[model samples]
Target chain A: MQDDIVLKTEDLTKHYGGVHALDGANFELKKGEHVAIMGDNGAGKSTFVRQITGVEQRTRGKIWLYGKEVNFTGPIDAREAGIETVFQTLALADDLDVPDNLFLGRELTFWNWLGPFRFLDYKAMRQATIAGLEKTAVKIPNIKNTIRNMSGGQRQCVAIARTATFHSRLTIMDEPTAALGVQETEQVENIIRQLKSVGEPLILISHNMRQVMDLVDRIIVFRRGRIVANLKRDETDGQDVVAYITGAKGDDVADVA
Target chain B: MAETSHGTGGLTFDKSKRAWPNELNIFIALILIICIFEALGQLLPYMNGQSLLFDTKGRFDSIFNEARIKIIILQVSIIGIIALGVTQVIIAGGIDLSSGSIVGASAMIAMSFAQTELVNGNPNPKAIFGPWAMDLPAIIPVIVGLLCGMLAGIINGVLIAYTRIPPFIATLGMMVSARGVAKWWSRGNPISFPTEDYAWIGSGMMPVIWFVLLAVLFHIILRYTVYGKHTYAIGSNEDAARMSGIKVARHKVLVYTIAGMLASFAAIILSAKNLTAQSGMGLVYELDAIAMAVIGGVSLAGGRGSIIGTCLGMLIFGVIISGFTYLKLDAFYQEMVKGFIIVAAVVLDQWRQKKAAAKT
Candidate 1:
């Protein structure tokens, strides 16, 4: 319940029928801290992120954000509560242009008295989109081109920019660079660095050990639905994190339940 | 990169890379078809030369053949109403096969409410209801027709969104059921003798007026409204829409419901204009409406069309029908040629998509 603790979760567990996708995860993230979630496939890394972002319902868990206990019904609720996420799927409407995709769900509207019949404020959204892109130092050749025509890196940058544009309290990204080329990956990493320079808190889920070590202050390793190890970047190496991920090392937090 | 050279304000637009707007392309097609018919009018030997859309002999007050133009506009207007709704449904990535049947059922029900108490100083012989329902206001019948459409749309939306049935199958079921309702409404007999107020709604060029008004309203709605954006977003990528926190299922219901209301409105106009309604009304009208949307450049794939394009498509349909009759072509040939045009439009759509994809 401290002001510095941006997000805290206790006993977060999700079971898909017989499969325990995520179990007994007790985690905490402080303000301005960058944490990396590293695990192999089916190690509950994505599942854990989904639980926090309300993309899926948790079987039983308590999540506290900025000292307030909250339960999200859907992704929208989480987003409204200042939790922005760059999902692994890179959820961008292919036929919509940059501004449209950036303001997809939460569009700015004029004619407030018209209630549900309000019109989209295209000019305002375009301006904000331009500002967001500039803030992230991302250059797009054409803001009017649909996402379908954009390069993979440009799409990824759009998603990241969406998270940044909203001035969210917490940002979570899952495998953002998985599909990008070397240069594109560097561009995404630079965006992340920008977030850090602004003193923003972030949770990055990546499988690349090098990326995890280079970008995050702390690395949380998950193995078989539980937090196996929480290692500081300065105190631990890739081998130590992998040892815990592969279940060769004992659990660092004994009281996960 | 050449396309990105044009700067407006601080941002550059790839205007050169952009193809002509779909609506513009459809408008051009409409003009080309008219020109072809005009050429045929001059080239063919029909005892004497006659213009297709012009009054060469100065028979009318206007420069153009106002009579033929009126006929073309009037013939397409009723069905064009249904196409307006079908365009939205298709843009939302769904199909509604029930629109035509909804039209039939709604027209029959609405006319029953709209009938006068006495026909020429006698009890109405074709009344579907008792005197209590007779001589109702025009708005009563209009609302009744809209409700019929709305109910059918809700069922279609629920089935497609919640039950997860394919839109084609769900709407097809409604299509058959609605047609049955139309027949059962009055034992397959036509309902006639609509009240004077109701009759005025569809008198003469009123249908065309209604079509133009609705087309303009929907065109703006699709272009500038939040509802329009959400509809396009859902059609463009449903998963992305959901992840962005859009209520996909509920939105689907809204889209189908609106489409149903439009179809019902079309039915009301058709029945009022005819001064009667039959169970056989609007038979195959759904296909015509859909054909209009597709021909206008509304993609069957969804999320990539406009109301303007559909309107232009409607005009093309009107021209083809009118042109065929002017050319003295058999009615049967119209069907064959219509089929060819529909297939060609879809082929063109696929080519456009591929070209857009290749540009990136």
Candidate 2:
């Protein structure tokens, strides 16, 4: 338990009735460090993320955030504990506008004494949304337009902005650029760069080697439900990471029980 | 910062691109329907050219036929209350087929509690309970009605949310069960002789007053409250709502429960206004309430409607029903025409959705 280690998981395992989607993932992320999780399809990358974020329950594991052992009941619990995630699906309510989607679960309200009858502070949420979008240099033609009308890139940006807007302690992105075009992908990468500039810690789950190498300080490769290799970005090449991912190379460290 | 257009040739803020609000469109439809009926009043050779809404023949002091207007408003008001709740359910991507049945069951139960000890200086002949239950405060019966509706709603919500049952099937089950309860409550006999206080609740345009108040309250709730936002969010994308940390199951329960309470309130008003309750009360009223919501522009697909639209839709229904009678149309023909109108409204909604999609 050290202040420098932002997140630690030991023996984290998930089984879907005999299918071990994630197993014995012993990992650590340091304060202000960006890490990439790379694996082939069904290599347990998303499953590992889900376990950490409490999107799914872990069969056997321990998670420590900021050096305190914590268990999350749901995504809301993880979020309130200062973990923000941009899921692979983007997770935007299509019919809601930018501000509405940004503040979906955690809306700002006035007339607090009204309890359930309190009114949404539309002006405040709108202002914060604009500021958040500007922080990531995301351009949306109309913030008032519903997410249904926005381009794929705009929707992705909004989801990312939501993570950024809340000033969350840890941010996680899963395949954010998988569905974006070349230019949109660069736009998302720039947002990640902004996060690095602000010295915020991030965990990115992606398959693109070049983007991973460029954006993160460390790369954690997953192979068949285990962490096969942990490579420092400056000391390893894409081929080395790919070698571990495809099982061409053996685990660099013993797989934890 | 230079705005990057992302190859869209620069995003243009075209005023014309903005579609008219759905509520405005509904309001316009209401006016058009009224105009059509007014034109028909002049065109149809109905006993020497009588006006439909206007007192053109000098039948009343006001420019409009005050009596006909009152009747039209009064007829729609009771069901309009139910439509308010139905609008919320539909907006949250759920349906409440039990609302009409809830009305029937609540009316029968509430009236029994609201009964006076003596009917015209004699023991209450229609009393379902002994003197101990007789002449309770009007609030007691109202609360009884609301609790009944709330309980029914909770069952519907739990089935849909926790059990993962489709809203249509869950509510349909409640619909049948509630109607049975209504009949079983008094063994299929009508309950009458409500206390004077209870009777005053539905007397003389009170139903209309209640409808207006509830409509305004719900309109604000839907437009401005956190509950309203979650309801719309859940309807728009339930998984997204969950990921955003919304309590989807609990919220569903709340929405359905509120809808049930509204339906029960409508029942209370109906029974009080009639001074009696029958097991047959509110038969097919669910369809009428849903029709009002649909006609007002509440989408069956959910997450894209308003209380204002439903209110305007209610007015259109009232006009159509009143207009048909003025035109001397048969009841069966009116029913057929009402069915056609409901179908047409949904078609129009689909068309509008497509057009909106195309614009983007």
Candidate 3:
């Protein structure tokens, strides 16, 4: 239980029947340290994240967040514990507008003055959403328009903005720019950079080598359900990370030089 | 940013040129249908100068035929309650075929509790219980009906949510099972001779009043509450909703339970209105309610509709049926026309959805 350790997972293992999706993964993230988890498809990077975020329960694991041992039953539990996540699907209600999507599970509601009736504080939520968007520099033409009407880039920005809206202790993004265009991807990367400047810890899961190399303080590569390499940004290049991802390097430790 | 078009399903296609909202489109069609009926009344030789719904004769208290108006509203009100629940369910991306059967079961069970101790000067022949159960309070019967509906709904919700069964299959099973329960309750016998207290539940325009009140309440809930937001979210994208921390399964169950309770309420109204209840009381009511929601612009694909739209659709339904009867159309022909209208409304909704999709 160390205050400096933002997130720590000990021997996290997830088994889908007899198949091992993620196995005995040991990982750690320091406060305000931007980290990347990179691996090829089916290399269990997503599975590992899912377990940490409580999208899927691990067979055995102990997750500590902000120096407190926590076991999330589902994504909601993880979220309530101050772990904000932008899932691969973006997890946005497409029929809802930008503000509504931003406040999907966490809405501003007040009890009726006279009765037991509860009312959603749409005006307040809208203002907060605007302020949050401005904070992240994620702009949309209209917050009234539903997500279905927005372009791909706008939808992604809204998703990322939602994670930023609340003061999350740890933010996890799974392939945040996978479907984004060059400009949209750049926009997302800038938001990530803003998070770094604000001294916020981040765990970004991506296959984009350039993105991982450019945005993170460290890279953790996964191969066949296990963490194969943990390399500091100053000590690793794209070739070394790719080799680890492709399982060309077997050792868990890599050269620091 | 410049383009703004009102599309069907309450969606605004900002990039498209222009089109009417689905609700407005339905409204215009409603007026057109009325005009068509009016014209037919004047054109046909058998009509004898009688209008479909207007004050052509000027004999009634108001412009419209008061009796006909009463009948039309009453005809749709009881089932309208069920539509409110179904609308929520559909918006949450599920269908309920068990509503009609739930109506049947609830009506029969509620009526059994509502029986008087005496029938026409003799001991109650239709009584399903002992003297202690006779002539009980109206609240007892209403509660019984609601609980029965709630039980059925819970079952439907649990099966669909926890078991991961498709909504269609789970509700279809409930439909059959509930119908069987209705028939078995009194061995297919009809229950009648309710107490005065029970009879007052659906007397006169009470059913219509109930429908309007429930519609308004649910409208507010759907438009200005978290419940409404979650329903739309789940229907729009279940996976996204779950990831956002919605209790998808629990919400599904809650939706179904409410739907069942509404269906049960409809049954109580119907039985009270008729002063009788039989196993066949709610046959096809589910389809009729679904049709109303669809006609009102409720998308079968989920996550796009409104209470106002459904209410308007109910009126349209009532008017069409009344118009057909007034025109001296055969009952058989009316059924076919109703089916056609349902299909046409869905096709219209589809076209609107496609237009919006293309614009974006």
lDDT tens digits, residues B95-150, model 1? 98999999999999999899999887899999778889988878999999999999
Which residue runs of candidate 1 sit more than 4 Å off their true CA positions? Answer: A113-115, A248-257, B1-19, B58-61
CAPRI-style quality class for the chain A–B interface of candidate 3: acceptable
Better of 2 and 3 by TM-score: 2
Off by over 4 Å in 3: A1-3, A9-26, A57-62, A112-117, A224-240, A243-252, A255-257, B1-21, B59-61
Q: Which stretches of candidate 2 lie over 4 Å from their true place?
A: A251-257, B1-19, B58-61, B121-123, B358-360
Q: Please, what is the whole-model Cα lDDT of each candidate in the order they appear?
A: 0.89, 0.89, 0.87
DockQ of 2: 0.41
Candidate 2 residue-wise lDDT, B1-360, digit = tens: 124232222332333455468888888888888898888777877535677778876655578888899999999999999999999999999988999999999999999899999887899999899989998999999999999999999999999999999999999999999999999999999999999899999999999999999999999999999999999999999999988878899999999999999999999999999999999899989999999999999988888899999999999999999989988889999899989998998898889778767865
State residue B170's C-alpha deviation in candidate 1, in Å: 1.4
Better model by DockQ: candidate 2 vs candidate 3: 2
Ten residues in sequence with the least summed lDDT for candidate 1 chain B: B2-11
Clash pairs, candidate 1, are none
TM-score of 3: 0.89
Question: Each model: TM-score of chain B?
Answer: 0.95, 0.94, 0.93
- The lowest-lDDT stretch of 10 consecutive residues in candidate 1 chain A is A248-257
Please state the CAPRI-style docking class of candidate 2.
acceptable
lDDT tens digits by residue: candidate 2, A141-172: 77778887878888898899887778888999
